[model samples]
Structures are given as structure tokens and as C-alpha cells.
Target chain A: MNLDELYQTVILDHAQRPRNYGELPQATAFAEGNNPSCGDEVTVYVKLDANGEKIEDIKFKGAGCAISQASTSLMTVKLKGKTVAEASKFEKTFHDMMTAVTLPEYPQGFGDLQILEGVRKFPQRVKCATLGWNALKQALGGNSSHDPVTSENE
Target chain B: MINAEQLRNDFPILHQQVNGRPLVYLDNAATTQKPLSVIETLDHYYRKDNSNVHRGLHELSNRATEAYEHARRRTAQFINAASADEIVFTRGTTEGINLVANSWAFDNLKPGDEILLTEVEHHSNLVPWQLLAQRKGLKLRFVPALANGESLDLAALDSLLAPPVKLFAFVHISNTLGLINDAKQFCALAKSRGITTLIDAAQSSGHRPLDVRDLDCDFLVFSGHKMAGPTGIGILYGRAELLEKMSPWHGGGEMIAAANYESSTYKPAPHKFEAGTPNIADAIGLGAAMDYLDKIGRDNIAKHDMELAAYAYEKLSQLDFLRILGPKTNRAGLITFVMDGVHAHDVVEIANTYGVALRGGHHCNQPLMKKLGTPASARASFYLYNTKTEVDRLAEVLHKIKEYFTR
Candidate 1:
């Protein structure tokens, strides 16, 4: 229930000056994630390599709470230059970190994302933390048909 | 004068601490905490008389049926409906509105008819009509909010009330803005135009004195949970004449008069509307809530609500970075505001750590939020159990939240 645990310094920094924040004109896949409960929306756009395996570029655009914005910003930074399969694995690791019963060990390359592990203490904000990742997952799954990824479903 | 300090004793949940701080609950607009009497009533119903109503031949069944019907009568008296038959019990206000939309509007409204609604309506009041309009080839029109986003533009109502408008449905109080619209005046205008009217009294019913006859609305819906009752029970009060004419929304066991494989006849009005085995215990609990509210006097409660809201509004107005929504005067016991450069979810999360419960979202009024040009805002709604001290706690927490974020 501690506020500091949820709003860590790095999380706040990323929230204030989000990295890779905007639309991607040459996006190969795109999806919008919506938290209907709070009206928070994040549109994730991805441009894959010509071979369609690696994520060459990634961007997100939306307005939300500090957790949602910061989580998405850190996600774009982590997923860039990784293969599509690695990005999915990263998402699974992040999801496991947020949902684990006890504070699990942070693996290598976890980086700033480890700050979001505190979200598990507040079950309600877990959805806020995953709002962007849900859209990222949709984009990687080839959701260019523009179906919205709702956190409620997850 | 209503003593909120004394009233707090009746609501046991108000005495607890959250996050190592005394809980200051300001989320009453979403749902009010149930009083001891309502809780005891539910306990008593389950412990003593638990049985199906209207179909059983045993003593427990008679008792359950009596208590269930008594709840209907109490609900009728709570809103001053003409008779118990006028009150049709539904799940809550959403289901009540949907009931009217399906049973009455679908049967009466034609392809080209338009349903006029206000811009400040909660999604429950707006969406049901939208779905119905889409299905029946009907058009939906809105009475826009004024520039201040506090009240409706009554001047434009003259044009919107013209022919082809079969119904005018609106909220009695804006859940997001906290403005109490003039239900009596609105109903009168609709009556003059020969258009039926439905008032969503979900926010107004428990906070103030309501008289369906006095307001002259054709149909009014309210949730019991918002008025110190249990969830899963609400009342939809339609004029007896209208209830007699409209068909039932649900069809099942209890509503039938005579049934066979060929065809079945249905009972009249209220019973026909309540189809399956209803939430009998919660209905009884709602009856107890009505009795509790009556004993305290709704007029005194309304006065207390207004005092707290005004006090909170003035107190929060001191903050330079806060933008308060709704008019300063003549508002319900709620305040909705947005802070500079901070999302409502953040404000609410920070406030929660200080043991202040707030609703941080569009308050189910997305259309109104869109009109106000904000994605979301934080709201603190007061009730009879709330006090000036709690409002002070909320104000203090807001200051801390602002400082924490801005630092």
C-alpha cells in the first residue's frame, strides 16, 4: 500500500519524459489498448524488419496514469531491436513478475521494469501497469485489423 | 440538523481503518455503505424465512412472499408512487432503464421517431436508448449542456421537444457534474409536448426527498444500493396506466397466470415484470433501508448533504491548480475535479494511501466527459454518513497528492 513502491523514481522519470512516444507512419502492425474502467488508452505501433522477425521500431501514444504511461515507455525501450519471439517472452516475464505470489527474482536484462514489480502489491493497478503491454501483445500478434485490446479481458 | 457523527455509528463499515489511516469514504455516489439495520434484515431473512415466493404452499413461502411484497410497498412509499403495483423490482437502475427500453419503447416507438436525452446522462440512461434506437431505426438527439457544463440548456429544449420525439429521458442529478437538474420543470415541458418522460433518479433518490406524483414523471428508476440498501435490488416506478399497457421485459416462472405447452397467460403489472425467482432477501433489505431513511427524514439529509458539498467546494477551491467541475451552488453532495498535469487515477491512488476513498474515472458519463473535454477526472461524493471533518481529510489529501506529484 506504500505509494513510493508503486511510483518509483525511475517510473516517474519515464512517465514524465516518455521514450518513443508518438505514432509510427510505417507501422507493420498496430493496436489500441483501452482501460475502459478509467478511460486510459494506449495505441502501440510497431515496424518490423523486412524479414518480419525483428522489431525494428516501436512507438506508443496515449494518456494515462503514471504507472500505465511509464510501463509502456519502458516496454518500448526494452522491446526495440529484439526479435518478435523475444518480445513475447519479455512480455511473459513481465506478466509473471507482476503476478507472482512473492517478489520473484529479477532476471538479467530486467532493468527499469523491475520497478513495476511493486504493482503486485496493489492488485488494482496491475491492470494499469499492463495496459500498454496488452496493446503491444496485440500488435505483435498482427492485430492490424484495429481491434481494441481491453485490459478488462486480461 | 442531521448529526453525521451519530449516523456513522449505524454504518459499521465507516469505523474501520485503511492503509494505517482512518477511512474517509467519499465514494458514496458509486455505492453507499449499508447501515446495520439493512444488514440485519438480510441476515434475518436468510436465517428465518428462506423460500420461493408466490408458488409455494408452505408457511416459509408465505413469509418470504409477504416480506418480498412488503418491500415493493415500501419502495412505492419511498418514492410516493401511487400504489405498490406501480413499482417493478429490477436488478438495479440499469436493468430498470433497459426494461423500459425493451418493453415500452420497443412496442411504442416507430422507425423515424427520435428519443431526446440530455448530454449529461450516465451511460445506463444513454446506452439503452442508443441500442433501442439502432434496432428500431430510431434517431437519438441530445440536449446539450451549457457552457459551464453544470446544467442543461433549457432554451434549446423548445426545439428539441418538437414532434417525432416520442420520449425525453434524462438524469435527475449528474453523477459527474453533481448538478441537480429541475426534474419537475423538465417533466412539465415534456408533458406539454405530449412526450413521455423517464427520470434516472439513481443519484437523487436517497440523497433527497423524491415524489413521483409531485415531479409528474411518467417513469422513474432508482437503485437500492445507492440508498443504504443491498445490491441486486432496485425499483422502476411507472405510472399504473403505462405499466398496464406495456408488456413484460422478462418471461419466466413467477409471472405467469396460467401456463401450458400451448400458450400461457401473464399476471398484471409488477408481477409480470418480475419474472424469475427474484432477489427476495435483498428486496427485504431494501425495505429496511427505506425505513431507516424515513426515520432520519430525507429533508434533513438533503440539507446536510448540501452543507457538506458547499463546504467541500469552498475548501477545495483554495487549491490554485485544481479545476472544479459543476456549478458552485445548488449541486448535489459531490465534487468532481481535475488537477493540473495529473491524471485522475494518480490522484485517486495517492489519496487511497491516505485512507480516502474516491472514484477516479468518467463516473459512467463518458459522453459528458467528452463534452467537458477531459478524458477523466476524480470525484468525491458524500452521503448522510459523511461530515465536514471527512471533507477536510479529503482536501488535505488532495494537497499532499498535488505536492507529491509536482515535486
Candidate 2:
């Protein structure tokens, strides 16, 4: 219910100036995430290391509400340089944080992503907060299918 | 004039607060709040005459069937249909359109026949035809909206209404843009060409007085919920001759006159189309809603709607950062706009903090949004109960939202 909590200063800043934005043409894996209800869409592109086991870089390109854009922007900053398994683990943790009935204790090493926990209070916006993470999860899930990942299905 | 302040008292839900603020329900286009009469009607039906309609011989069954049939007659009268037999009940506007598409178009149209629609149709009006076109090898054409994104390009109608265009289906009002199309003129044009016409009056029915006879459209569809009735009830009015020609879309209990394992004889037009046990209680509730609206006078309500929309549009236009969609004048009871730096969802979310409910998204008009050059926009729709003061509140909240996002 607190507007300040939902639109944290850090989240707003990230949304205004997203990190690692735009297409990664040399990317190995990429997937699009869409929230059809609100018309929010983001494509997360991942560049894995030589072994294809670790994400060397991650980037995104799309337009949406601040929660969606910022969550994806912050996600790129968190997942880069982490192994695919670790990224998947973080995704599960992030999903839990967003979907929890009450504010769970902040998971360590989540960094600025903790600001998104405010999304838990607004049930309708949970999809907006998770849209980007769902795409990143899809990119790393090895399907790399052409069909855009939807938050509704996840 | 209808006193909105007095009318607001009839809606119990409008008195509540959201997030510690008085709720300003500007989402009327999505669904209008039900009146006490409608709510009581629903309760009365379930509490007293709760039985299956059409076939029951018991006292309750007779009451239920009479009430259900009375609702059908009320709907026919509400829209000024030539006869109650012309009215078919469906889940809502979407179901009504799908019913016509499946029953009428499926039987009549041939492969390569084109259906003329507007660029501004809601998905309900567009998608059914798309599915039908794919299935029957039919072609589809569109009448584009003007560059202003308000009115349909009537100039283009002549070219699009070529011989192959068998049916011309369009929205009576743009749910997103709030533009009221000239249904009468459009219907006349289609009729002159000997092409069948269907009007999507989902937005127009309760907000304004409607006469299917006056519009002269072969088929017209509208939802009860949009007009202050219960959900899951709507009307599809077809001309008597046309209704007789169309086959039944849903096959079940009430639609049949005689049944055997191999085949069954179907009832007349309206009953034949309505298969299974109908939404008896809600249909009766819709009748009550029509009574309530009639008491207030739909002409007065229509004037109030336009006044509220015009007032809201002026208030919103004062903000330098906002770009309003739809025509500047003669719009329905709504305003759709986008803030310069704020996403529509964010605008809606922040406005909720102030208890001003708004609709933000494609509003089931994705292609129209694309043409208008915005992914989505925020809309504040008014009804009979909404007032200029609420429009002021909306404008104030929008200003605060702009400052919050920009600062």
C-alpha cells in the first residue's frame, strides 16, 4: 500500500537508466517474456562463457512499466558472471520473494533486487515484477524456443 | 437532468474506500457497478423462484420460466426490438458475436467472401471473424480510422464495401478511444449494398438510448454488465427474418422442441440459439437494471456521460505531459490518455493510491493501440453516477502521478 515502498528510489533509477540494455547480437541464447495482460514485453539475451556453463554477459531490450523494466535491468546486473546453475537458483529465490504471502527475510547477496520485494503487496503487479526474471529463466532453460515466455504460464 | 449525486446512493459499492481513500470508480467501461434494484432482483429470484425454466410444471418452475421470459421481453423493449422473439440471451457481448459468427456467417458466407470491419474493433468483434475466415477460406477487410484516431474514415467505406464483402461488422463505440461511431449511417450503407451488418453496442447500450429498429442493423450485441446489470447476461438482437434463417449455435436442453437419438427438432429463433439452462437469475436482474435506467431516463444518462467525458478531457488536456486519445468532442463517457514519462500501468497503480480507479492496458484493442502509436494507455470511463468532481479528483491524481514519476 505504500507507494514509496513499491517504487523505491533505486528501482526508479534502474528503470530510468537500465544497465546492459539493447540487443546482444553475438548472444548464444535469448528469449522474450511477455505480460499479455498489460502489454509489457522484454527480451533477455544471455552470452555464456566458452564452456557455455557460465553467463559472461546478460542484456535486455523492451518497454514496460517501471517494475518490469527495472526488475529486468537489475536482473542483468545480478546474473552476469554467474554460472547457469547459480542463475537458476537465484531465479527460484527471486520467484519465492515475489510470490510470498508476507515479506520473507531478505536473501543474502540479492543486492538491489531486494527493492522488488515491495511488489508482494500489489498482487496484480507481481507479474510485472517477475516478467523479466521469467524471460531470463527461459533463456537459460535450454529450450531457446521462438515462442515468447509468458508470466501467466510460469 | 439525472442527479448523479442522488444516483450514486443506489450503488452500495460506490460508497466504499480503497487504500484509505474514497473510491472514485472511473472504470465504467470495463464494468459498471450494479444498482440496488439489480442486486435485489438477483436476490429475489434466487430466494423465491429458483427453478429450471421452460419445462418445469411445478409452481416454482412456472414462476422461474415466466420471470426468464419477462426478462427477454424487457430486453427486447429496452433496445426497442420489433419483437421479443428477436432477442437471444448469451453470456455477454463476446458470446453474442461468436454466436452470430458460428450460426449465421458459417451458414451463409462462401469461401473468398470478405467481411468488412473497422480498424478500431475490440478483439471480440475481430477475432471470431478471423477464426471463421481461416476456417472457411474467407477474406477480411478493414475500414481504417481517421488520422486523428477518433472517427472512422467514412471516405474509405466506399472502396472497402465491394461486392465480395458479405458482412460489415463494427463497434458502435470504441471501448478504448470512446468514439461513438454512426451506427445508423453505417448500417444504411451496408444495407444499401445488400450486405448484412452487425453492431457491437457493448459500450453504447446502457449509456445511451438504443433502438435496433431505428439503427436498422440486422444484428446488434451488448453486455448487461456494462450497463448496470449483472455479469454473464447480454443480448443479441437479430431481425425476425434473419434470426429465422440462422441455425442454432449451441445444442442442448431448452433449445429443442422434440428429441430422438438420431435428431431433434429445434425451437424458434431466440430459444433455438439459447441452449441448455440459461442464466435465469442474471437475466431477471438485467430486466431490473433496464427498469432502473428507464426510471432515470437513458437520454439524460447519455447527456451526463458525454458531459463527464468532455469535462474530464478538458481537465486532462491542461496537463502538458499528457496526450489524450479519441476525438475532442462527441465522444462517449470516457477519456483515454498516456502520460509523457509514465507507463499506463504505473499511472493506474499510482492513481489507485488516491483511490481513483482507472483502466490501463491495450483494453482488448491491441491493434488499435499499435495504430495509435502507444503500447497502452490509461482510461477513465464515466457512467450515470460519475460526476465532474470525480473528474477533478482524477485530474489532481494524474498531476500528482506525473510529479511523482518525473521528480
Candidate 3:
């Protein structure tokens, strides 16, 4: 019922000064995702290791609500150095953490992506949390030149 | 011209505080909130006259039927159609268009026959025809927008007009662009070519005065909720003879005259199309809504909305980097725009911070969005209850947004 609770300090910190806040100029793998329902959009640029399996660098740039931008900030930080396989697994793990009847056990040693647990109370912003992860899967899927296309996950 | 400040008092929702500020709702294009009268009508219907119609001889059912049928007659006369029998109630404008495209276009259109539509049609209008064209093997032709220097060619419409042009299904006022088609010019042209025109009056009916008999448009459709009426009810008007010719869109109890094993004769026109139990309460509510509009005067309401739209367009256009993406002429009661370097979602969120409610995004018009080369826009539309002050507040929000983002 509290709007203040929805915009907690953790969410605002990531929103005001997002972690991976700029474009990677040398990003060979890129994908742009847009929420057709609300017009929230984010384009992710990922510099992959030469094999295009592990993320070397990742960043996002777009305009949206505070929740959306911060969620993207949190998502990208979770994505760096993650293998394509691990990035895909993190997609399911992130969703479980956000909207479960019971919270999924957070994996140890993973950093600030856990902050997105705030989004579980606000179900509407799940699109914001997943926007970056969707782009990562597309980039690593070897269709890096293509804009992010809708899949079963989208 | 209507006392907009006084008019705002009747809407309970508009008077409320949002984020410690007055709720300046300008999102009529998306959904207009319920007026007190409309809300009361809903409560009254359920509390008193709740029953099935036409079959029950009981007092409640009888009154409910009378109110429901009264709405049918009002909807018919609101558009100046010949009679109530011609009005077919559907779920909304999307279903209404699909019914026309499938039952009429699919049946009548053959290969090489052209179905003409404007470039700015809502996806509801555009998509049904797209699917119909594909399925029926008919040529779906578009009257692409007249872009300055983008096309030195004559309006493709004039050249596209041919004898085999079977139908002209286009919006009376475009949902996104707010372009009010000159019914005389466009309808006259389509009539001359023997094109059976279906005007999507979804935008025009409440915002402007429309006369189907006067416009000479063969088919017209408008949704209820757009005009301060209840949702889940829409009007589809077809010429009486044409209604006689076209088959029913759905079939069930009320639509049928008699049913045996494998053989059934359907009831005439409107009833035949209206399958199952109708939105009886909302139908009555639409009648109340029309009565409310008539009390204010439709012509006066129309003029008032146009005045607000023109004012909003002028003031909003003058702001730095604010672009109104619609007709420059006297438009319908809305201005779809985008501020420079600020996305529409951000604009909506920032505007919400200022207690201004508006619509953002492509507004269900993907083809038009692609034509304009933008993903989405922020729309501050007006209605009878909207004011120049709200427009001024909108301009202030954009000014503050430019400050918020750039400075």
C-alpha cells in the first residue's frame, strides 16, 4: 500500500547511479528489447570473449521509470563474465526470485542482482528486471547483429 | 464553451488528489473515467432492474428490456441512422471491424478486387483487412499519407480509385494522427467509385457530431467506452438492406427464430448479430451516457473538444522540443506528441509525478507508428470534461520535463 516501500532506497541507488550505465563501444554482440505493453525499452551492448561464449563487458542505455532503469542496472552487473549458458540459467533464477510463492534460495557469491528481490512485491516491473537478460541470450545466440526478437521467454 | 471547471465537478475521480496533487487526467484516448451519472446508472441497474430481457414477462426483466432496447434506439439515432434494427452490438470496435472484414470483405472480395484504406488506420482497422486480403486473395491497397517532398506524386488515392474497388474501410478521425477526414470529399469519392465505405467512427462519434445519413457512409462503428459510456459495448451500423444481405457474426439463443436438429433460421438484422445475453446493464448505461451528452448538446460538446485540442496543439507546439504529431488543421480532441531527447515512457512517468495522466506508446497503431518512424508518443487527449487549464498543466509538465532531463 505504501509507494515509499515500492521505491525503496536500494532501488533508488541503482536507478540514480546505475552500475553499467554506458555503451561498450567495442561490443560485437548487441540486442535491443522493448516492452510492447508499456513502451519501456533497453538496448544492451555486450562485448563477448572471442568465442562469443563469455561476456567480457556489458552495459545498457535507455529511458524508462526508475524501477526499469535500476532493474537493468542490477541485471547487467549480474551478467558480466557469465557464460552464455549461465546467463540463460540466471534468467529463470531471476524470475523465480521475483514472483515465487516462496523465495528461491539465492545462489552464494553472486553480487547485487539479489537487490532485485524488491521487485517481487511489485510484479509489474518484472519486464524491467528481465529486459537485459533477454538481450544477453539473443547476443550470445549468434544472432548478435539482429535486434532482439521475441522468443518463448519474451 | 461548456463550463469545463463546473463539468469537472461531476467526475468524482478527477477531483481526487494524486501524489498530493489534483488528478489532471487527460488520457481520454486510452480510457475516460466514469462520470457520476454513468457510475450511478451501473449501481442502479444491478440493484433494481437486473434480469434477462425479451423472454421474461416479470417487471424487472420488462424494465431492463425497455432500457436496453431504448439504448439500441438511442445509438441508432445518435449517428442519424435510419432505424434501430440496423444497429448491431459487438464487444468493441475491434470485433465490429473483424465482423465486417470477415463476413462482408471475405464474402464479396475476389482476386484483383481492391480494398482501400488509409495509412493512418488503427491496427484494429488495418489488421482485419490485412488478414482478409491474405485469406481471400484480394489486393489490399493503401492510400499512403501525403508526405511533403517524401512524395512528389499525386495522392495515391485518386490514382488508386478504380471500378473493382469493392470497399473503403477507413477511420473517420484517425486514432493516432487526429486527422478528421472531410466526410463530404472522401465519402463522395468512394461513393462515386461504387466503393462500399465503412467508417471507423471510434474517434469521431463522441468528439464530433456525426450523421450517417448525412455523411452517406454505408457502415459506421464506434465503441461505447470512448464516449463516456460503459465498456464491453460497441455499435456497428450497416445500411438496412446491407444488413439484410450480410449473415450474422455470431449465433446462439436470442439470435435464432427456431432450432431443430441441424436446421435453424436466424432472427432479422440486429438481433441475429447479437448472440447470447447482451451487456444489458451497460446498454442501458450507454443510453444514459448519450442522454448526458445530449443534455450538454453534442454540437456544443464537439466544438468544445475541438477548441481544447486546438489550444493544446498551439501551446504544446510552442514549447522547446515538443512535437505534436497530428494534423495541423482543426483536429479531434487530442494531441499525440513527443518531447525531444526524452522517451514517451519517461515523459508519462515524469508527468505522473506532476499529477497529469496521459497515454504513452503507439496507441494500437503499429502501421502508423512505422510510417511516422517513431516507436511511440505521449498523448494528452481531451473530452467534454477536459479543460484549457489541464492543457496548460500539460504544457507545464512538458516544460518541467525539459528542465528535468536537459537542465
Chain B TM-score in each of the candidates: 0.99, 0.99, 0.96
The TM-score values for the models, in the order shown, are 0.95, 0.97, 0.88
- In Å, residue B201's CA in model 3 sits off its true spot by 0.8
A41-106 in candidate 3: lDDT tens per residue? Answer: 677888878886887898988765566777778778878888767777777677677666897766
Candidate 3 lDDT, B62-120, residue by residue in tens: 99999899889998888888999988888778889998987777777898888888777
**Native contacts matched by each model:** 0.85, 0.81, 0.27
DockQ of each: 0.74, 0.78, 0.32
Model 2: runs farther than 4 Å from truth?
A100-108, A142-146
Model 3: how far residue B366 lies from native, Å: 1.4
Query: TM-score of chain B, candidate 1?
Result: 0.99
Q: In model 3, where do residues sit more than 4 Å from their true spots?
A: A1-34, A38-53, A57-78, A82-93, A96-122, A141-147, A150-154, B147-154
Q: Candidate 2: fnat, from 0 to 1?
A: 0.81
Q: What TM-score does prediction 2 earn? A: 0.97
| Ranking of all predicted structures according to lDDT, beginning with the best and ending with the worst | 2, 1, 3
Candidate 1 local lDDT, A1-154, one digit each (tens)? 6789999988888888999999999999999999877778899999999999999999999988889999999999998998998898888888878876666566567777887888888888898899899898888888675668887654
Candidates' C-alpha lDDT? 0.91, 0.92, 0.78
Compared with the true structure, the alpha-carbon lDDT of candidate 1 equals: 0.91
How many Å off is the CA of A74 in candidate 2?
A: 0.7
Point out the higher-scoring one by lDDT: 2 or 3.
2
Per-residue alpha-carbon lDDT of candidate 1 for residues B56-152, written as tens digits (9 for 90 to 100) = 9999999999999999998888889989999998899999999999999999999999999999999999999999999999999999898657778
